[model samples]
Target: MLTLICQGSSFALHKMATGLRKGAKLNYKLMNEQGISLDTKDNSDNNDDQVAEDTRKDSVFSPVKSKAQKSNASSAEDDGKHSLPEEVDSDDQEIEKLQRELETLEKDEAKLKKIKQKEELRQKVVRKRDEVKALRDVRRVCIMGDSIIKHLPSIQGVSIFAFPGATIGKLSFLVDSRAVPLADFNFVIIHVGTNNIANGHSLQHMSSDFANLVASIRKFNKDIAIIVSSILPRPVDHSHTKSTVQQFNFHSQDYLASELNFKFIRSYRPFCFRGDIKRFLFAKRDGGLHLNSEGSNRLRFFFLRVISTLT
Candidate 1:
């Protein structure tokens, strides 16, 4: 009874092994098509066990099973006859699709980065251009007067053009360029008619001269405000001077107003009325009829008030 049981158990083990071999062969064939390899394997013990099992299966169901397994393996090996496993083929197709999608995504990411960098550079250039333009459009302070403005300290943003021996007749020629330049000015501080007075020019002539200057300025800058400056204090030394400069300040102001509507910066308030003529108005070295540092301060405030009102 023990010998019979041993034979039956060996036959049963051989049958199980044959089925395993057939399944393993099918798996290996599928793996081969997918380029999967287990070539580095050492199956010496399994091969010995399979040989013993095959010998025992000869007395069992070996003949029938071997014939069936051979037919199945032959059919599986023939590419024209049998199809690849559905699960394996599906996995390969999914992997290929995912790989293509990943590549496309990578290319799109690179393209977006390039576009973003280019946009940033364009904005930087535009900002730089605006900064340069702003710097060039600086404020220009235009001075329209006699030699007084020319000799004053270099005020910020200030430019000067004063006719030394100019009267109303020469004014058009004297300020042909500066009239337009000053017309487009941030501030036009004018102090003329002094030369007209010193040279014994008539009040009527002075008025005409002032009117011409205003007319020329208005031609260029229509909105430019005109400041009709009254004659500054003439010292006692120039008392023997030709024209009635003091009378001109009082009467010519009304004359200038009638000719045109403009503001008048009267100097009689600070320098001539309350202060010394020679000490306060003219520099001792200047000798000519011109304003000193103290006198310039009065003119400065007049322009300042003009600026404040406009702003």
Candidate 2:
């Protein structure tokens, strides 16, 4: 019985030792698997931290980059609006200068045109002078006055120097200026003073101016026969009445004719019918101021008859 007990104890001790070894191996394997799992979890945590940091960085800088781009665009637009290229600016300045030059040229051209017209008028007056000088008749007659004398035909050996609005005051200047050549003419017929009356000059002033004009004609030649024609009546417009014209004629015949020894022609009688001026004797458009064809013929015949008697 003691031998059997000793064998059984040895077997039990052996089994126990084997069981402890197996438990140690199982614990060691579990520890190794847990260590590997812990390591993988740590690596995943690190990767997640890196990704979040990258996202934060992007969020912070994106608005700043976009603002910088907008600022650049606005600056470019401002440059386009406020400033032009150098070449284009220079061309605009040149165009403005050319427009100014063209305006100046137009003003100069207008002035030149007026000057040319004035020169042409002066040349025409000079040509009239030349024509008058070409006539060399010694027994020449000259009629000088306003438009009434201008209507006188260009008779042989006669010079009619008449201005439309000539007054008695202007007659002396007309004669002195060689407008009426008094040197070669033997007879001078004057029919002015109508314009003087129309211009509101007093009768006394008109008579005085007439006397001075007569004196100027006498100065040219003492032998020259000066005939002072009466002022014709205007039946129309009534600016000058028949009485006023008669008064001026009476003054010329009574005072100037005797004083200056000049002939006074009563030219108003032929146009009068029963102490009134005949309307038919004057032009229809003239308002009874100027003569018609019949009146002009009568005047021409009277002048010829008077001129024939002078020689």
lDDT to native, each model? 0.68, 0.80
- Candidate 1: tens digits of C-alpha lDDT, residues 21-100: 99999999999999987664447667878998777665564554566667887877785444557667899999999999
- Residue 234 lDDT in candidate 2: 69
Tell me the deviation in Å of residue 252 in model 1.
4.2
- Name the 10 consecutive residues with the lowest summed lDDT in model 2: 60-69
Write the residue-wise lDDT of candidate 2 on 145-201 in tens digits: 888766776667677788988898798888777677688788899989878777778
Q: What value of lDDT does candidate 2 attain over all alpha carbons?
A: 0.80
Instruction: Report the CA-based lDDT of candidate 1 relative to the real structure.
Output: 0.68
- Could you tell me every candidate's TM-score relative to the true structure? 0.58, 0.53
Predicted structure 2, TM vs. truth: 0.53
RMSD vs true structure, all candidates: 19.7, 18.3
Clashing pairs in 2: none
Quote model 1's TM-score: 0.58
